[model samples]
Target: MSKQQPVLFSIGWNACINCGACVAICPQEAGFVSPFDTIAVDRPCDIACLLCESICPVDTITHVPVEQPAVSVVTVDR
Candidate 1:
Protein backbone atom coordinates (compact mmCIF):
# COMPACT_ATOMS: atom_id res chain seq x y z
CA MET A 1 0.00 0.00 0.00
CA SER A 2 1.12 3.52 -0.76
CA LYS A 3 1.80 5.78 2.20
CA GLN A 4 0.14 9.18 2.41
CA GLN A 5 1.54 12.52 3.54
CA PRO A 6 -0.50 15.34 5.03
CA VAL A 7 -0.30 18.87 3.70
CA LEU A 8 -1.82 21.94 5.20
CA PHE A 9 -3.11 24.17 2.46
CA SER A 10 -2.29 27.88 2.41
CA ILE A 11 -5.96 28.72 2.82
CA GLY A 12 -6.05 26.51 5.89
CA TRP A 13 -2.84 27.99 7.21
CA ASN A 14 -4.41 31.40 7.28
CA ALA A 15 -7.64 30.05 8.66
CA CYS A 16 -6.09 27.93 11.39
CA ILE A 17 -6.90 29.21 14.86
CA ASN A 18 -4.01 27.41 16.61
CA CYS A 19 -6.30 24.53 17.47
CA GLY A 20 -4.45 21.41 18.59
CA ALA A 21 -6.94 19.01 17.05
CA CYS A 22 -4.73 18.05 14.14
CA VAL A 23 -1.56 17.89 16.18
CA ALA A 24 -3.27 15.79 18.78
CA ILE A 25 -4.78 13.30 16.36
CA CYS A 26 -1.60 12.74 14.34
CA PRO A 27 -0.29 9.24 14.95
CA GLN A 28 3.09 9.93 13.37
CA GLU A 29 3.65 13.16 15.20
CA ALA A 30 4.44 14.75 11.87
CA GLY A 31 2.89 18.08 12.71
CA PHE A 32 3.74 20.38 15.59
CA VAL A 33 3.59 24.12 16.37
CA SER A 34 3.39 26.66 19.12
CA PRO A 35 0.15 28.06 20.41
CA PHE A 36 0.76 31.34 18.60
CA ASP A 37 2.19 29.89 15.40
CA THR A 38 0.32 27.56 13.10
CA ILE A 39 3.38 26.47 11.12
CA ALA A 40 3.82 22.68 11.18
CA VAL A 41 7.02 20.79 11.62
CA ASP A 42 8.13 18.45 8.84
CA ARG A 43 9.44 14.97 9.53
CA PRO A 44 10.01 11.64 7.81
CA CYS A 45 6.83 9.55 7.89
CA ASP A 46 6.31 5.81 7.35
CA ILE A 47 2.53 5.71 7.86
CA ALA A 48 0.08 8.36 6.68
CA CYS A 49 -3.10 7.33 8.39
CA LEU A 50 -4.85 10.68 7.65
CA LEU A 51 -5.83 11.14 11.27
CA CYS A 52 -4.89 14.76 11.06
CA GLU A 53 -6.87 15.24 7.87
CA SER A 54 -9.98 13.76 9.45
CA ILE A 55 -9.63 15.86 12.58
CA CYS A 56 -9.20 19.20 10.88
CA PRO A 57 -12.28 21.31 11.51
CA VAL A 58 -11.56 23.84 8.76
CA ASP A 59 -10.71 21.19 6.16
CA THR A 60 -7.22 22.60 5.86
CA ILE A 61 -5.48 19.26 5.83
CA THR A 62 -5.07 17.20 2.68
CA HIS A 63 -3.16 14.04 1.81
CA VAL A 64 -0.82 13.67 -1.16
CA PRO A 65 0.68 10.52 -2.57
CA VAL A 66 4.28 9.98 -1.55
CA GLU A 67 6.52 8.98 -4.43
CA GLN A 68 7.95 5.50 -4.17
CA PRO A 69 11.46 4.60 -5.18
CA ALA A 70 11.83 3.24 -8.71
CA VAL A 71 13.16 -0.29 -9.17
CA SER A 72 15.83 -1.05 -11.77
CA VAL A 73 15.96 -4.28 -13.77
CA VAL A 74 18.95 -5.78 -15.56
CA THR A 75 18.66 -8.29 -18.41
CA VAL A 76 21.37 -10.81 -19.33
CA ASP A 77 21.91 -12.04 -22.87
CA ARG A 78 23.56 -15.39 -23.63
Candidate 2:
Protein backbone atom coordinates (compact mmCIF):
# COMPACT_ATOMS: atom_id res chain seq x y z
CA MET A 1 0.00 0.00 0.00
CA SER A 2 1.11 3.51 -0.77
CA LYS A 3 1.54 6.03 2.00
CA GLN A 4 -0.69 9.07 2.06
CA GLN A 5 0.92 12.46 1.51
CA PRO A 6 0.58 15.18 4.11
CA VAL A 7 -1.53 18.24 3.34
CA LEU A 8 0.41 21.46 2.74
CA PHE A 9 0.05 24.86 4.36
CA SER A 10 1.27 28.33 3.34
CA ILE A 11 3.31 30.84 5.31
CA GLY A 12 2.13 34.43 5.39
CA TRP A 13 4.45 36.82 3.54
CA ASN A 14 3.65 39.75 5.82
CA ALA A 15 4.84 37.65 8.75
CA CYS A 16 7.83 36.08 7.04
CA ILE A 17 11.22 37.82 7.06
CA ASN A 18 12.51 35.94 4.01
CA CYS A 19 14.61 33.67 6.17
CA GLY A 20 15.90 30.54 4.44
CA ALA A 21 15.72 28.30 7.49
CA CYS A 22 12.48 26.70 6.39
CA VAL A 23 13.89 26.00 2.97
CA ALA A 24 17.05 24.44 4.35
CA ILE A 25 15.47 22.29 7.07
CA CYS A 26 12.62 20.85 5.06
CA PRO A 27 13.31 17.22 4.29
CA GLN A 28 10.89 17.50 1.36
CA GLU A 29 12.24 20.77 -0.06
CA ALA A 30 8.67 21.99 0.27
CA GLY A 31 9.61 25.43 1.56
CA PHE A 32 10.87 28.18 -0.74
CA VAL A 33 10.87 31.94 -1.08
CA SER A 34 10.13 33.46 -4.44
CA PRO A 35 12.01 36.41 -5.91
CA PHE A 36 8.71 38.23 -6.04
CA ASP A 37 8.68 38.63 -2.26
CA THR A 38 6.60 35.66 -1.23
CA ILE A 39 7.02 32.47 0.75
CA ALA A 40 5.44 29.25 -0.46
CA VAL A 41 5.09 25.62 0.45
CA ASP A 42 4.49 22.83 -2.01
CA ARG A 43 1.06 21.23 -1.69
CA PRO A 44 0.85 17.76 -0.17
CA CYS A 45 4.11 18.40 1.63
CA ASP A 46 4.14 21.61 3.67
CA ILE A 47 2.56 20.06 6.81
CA ALA A 48 3.38 23.11 9.00
CA CYS A 49 6.66 21.67 10.30
CA LEU A 50 7.11 24.66 12.70
CA LEU A 51 10.90 24.60 12.21
CA CYS A 52 10.58 27.90 10.43
CA GLU A 53 8.21 28.98 13.18
CA SER A 54 10.93 28.54 15.83
CA ILE A 55 13.88 29.84 13.80
CA CYS A 56 12.25 33.07 12.68
CA PRO A 57 14.00 35.91 14.48
CA VAL A 58 11.11 38.30 13.98
CA ASP A 59 8.47 35.83 15.14
CA THR A 60 6.56 36.64 11.99
CA ILE A 61 5.88 33.13 10.85
CA THR A 62 3.34 30.75 12.39
CA HIS A 63 2.64 27.14 11.62
CA VAL A 64 -0.85 25.69 11.69
CA PRO A 65 -1.27 22.00 11.34
CA VAL A 66 -2.48 21.29 7.82
CA GLU A 67 -4.89 18.52 8.67
CA GLN A 68 -6.80 20.82 11.01
CA PRO A 69 -8.82 23.87 10.10
CA ALA A 70 -9.76 26.77 12.31
CA VAL A 71 -13.40 27.16 13.20
CA SER A 72 -15.15 30.41 12.40
CA VAL A 73 -18.24 31.94 13.93
CA VAL A 74 -20.98 34.12 12.51
CA THR A 75 -23.59 35.81 14.65
CA VAL A 76 -27.02 37.09 13.69
CA ASP A 77 -28.93 39.54 15.85
CA ARG A 78 -32.44 38.49 16.71
Candidate 3:
Protein backbone atom coordinates (compact mmCIF):
# COMPACT_ATOMS: atom_id res chain seq x y z
CA MET A 1 0.00 0.00 0.00
CA SER A 2 1.24 3.51 -0.76
CA LYS A 3 1.91 5.82 2.16
CA GLN A 4 -0.14 8.94 2.58
CA GLN A 5 1.50 12.37 2.39
CA PRO A 6 0.75 15.46 4.42
CA VAL A 7 -0.89 18.51 2.88
CA LEU A 8 1.41 21.47 2.23
CA PHE A 9 0.58 25.17 2.36
CA SER A 10 2.34 28.16 0.85
CA ILE A 11 4.10 30.72 2.98
CA GLY A 12 3.17 34.29 2.20
CA TRP A 13 5.40 36.05 -0.34
CA ASN A 14 6.07 38.94 2.02
CA ALA A 15 7.51 36.58 4.62
CA CYS A 16 9.75 34.68 2.17
CA ILE A 17 13.22 35.98 1.41
CA ASN A 18 13.69 33.87 -1.76
CA CYS A 19 16.44 31.88 -0.09
CA GLY A 20 17.21 28.65 -1.90
CA ALA A 21 17.88 26.68 1.27
CA CYS A 22 14.42 25.08 1.17
CA VAL A 23 15.00 23.94 -2.39
CA ALA A 24 18.42 22.50 -1.66
CA ILE A 25 17.39 20.49 1.37
CA CYS A 26 14.00 19.15 0.28
CA PRO A 27 14.39 15.60 -1.02
CA GLN A 28 10.92 15.78 -2.54
CA GLU A 29 11.64 19.08 -4.34
CA ALA A 30 8.57 20.39 -2.58
CA GLY A 31 10.00 23.81 -1.94
CA PHE A 32 10.94 26.30 -4.62
CA VAL A 33 11.77 29.97 -4.94
CA SER A 34 9.75 31.46 -7.78
CA PRO A 35 10.86 34.14 -10.25
CA PHE A 36 8.53 36.62 -8.56
CA ASP A 37 10.70 36.48 -5.44
CA THR A 38 8.53 34.16 -3.38
CA ILE A 39 8.93 30.79 -1.79
CA ALA A 40 6.32 28.23 -2.79
CA VAL A 41 5.45 24.71 -1.68
CA ASP A 42 5.22 22.71 -4.89
CA ARG A 43 3.03 19.92 -3.52
CA PRO A 44 1.98 17.85 -0.53
CA CYS A 45 5.07 16.77 1.40
CA ASP A 46 5.22 14.53 4.44
CA ILE A 47 9.02 14.41 4.59
CA ALA A 48 9.00 15.74 8.21
CA CYS A 49 12.41 17.21 7.45
CA LEU A 50 12.84 20.55 9.17
CA LEU A 51 15.64 21.70 6.87
CA CYS A 52 13.57 24.54 5.48
CA GLU A 53 12.93 25.99 8.92
CA SER A 54 16.53 25.65 10.01
CA ILE A 55 18.16 26.99 6.82
CA CYS A 56 16.01 30.10 6.54
CA PRO A 57 18.38 33.00 7.20
CA VAL A 58 15.57 35.49 7.72
CA ASP A 59 13.61 33.13 10.00
CA THR A 60 10.69 33.35 7.61
CA ILE A 61 10.10 29.68 7.09
CA THR A 62 7.95 27.86 9.61
CA HIS A 63 6.86 24.22 9.72
CA VAL A 64 3.91 23.53 11.98
CA PRO A 65 2.86 20.04 12.94
CA VAL A 66 -0.36 19.03 11.21
CA GLU A 67 -1.83 17.12 14.11
CA GLN A 68 -1.72 19.96 16.58
CA PRO A 69 -4.96 21.86 16.98
CA ALA A 70 -5.18 25.63 17.28
CA VAL A 71 -5.36 26.74 20.90
CA SER A 72 -7.54 29.75 20.22
CA VAL A 73 -11.26 29.30 20.80
CA VAL A 74 -14.18 31.69 20.80
CA THR A 75 -16.68 31.38 23.61
CA VAL A 76 -19.70 33.55 24.10
CA ASP A 77 -21.96 33.34 27.16
CA ARG A 78 -24.74 35.85 27.54
Which of candidates 1 and 3 is the stronger one according to TM-score? 1
Native-to-model Cα distance after best TM-score fit, residue 33 in candidate 3, in Å: 6.7
lDDT of 2 at 56: 59
Better of 2 and 3 by TM-score: 3
Candidate 3 ranges beyond 4 A from true positions: 1-9, 29-42, 64-78
Give the candidate order by descending TM-score: 1, 3, 2
TM-score of each candidate structure, all chains considered together? 0.52, 0.44, 0.50
Per-residue lDDT for 1-78 in model 2, tens only? Answer: 112323444667676777666656655443354453334544334334456557656766543344422224323338
Question: Candidate 3 local accuracy as lDDT?
Answer: 0.52
The residue-by-residue lDDT of candidate 1 on 1-78, one tens digit each, is 323442432325676667778667655433454344433434323355666667778877654443431224323337
Q: What is the C-alpha RMSD of each candidate to the true structure, in Å?
A: 7.7, 10.4, 10.2
Which residues of candidate 2, in runs, are more than 4 Å off?
A: 1-5, 29-39, 46-49, 60-78
Please, what are the lDDT tens digits per residue for candidate 3 over residues 8-75?
54565577766676667656543344554444455344555556667677766654445422224323
- In candidate 1, where is summed lDDT lowest over 10 consecutive residues? 68-77
* Candidate 1 global CA lDDT score: 0.50
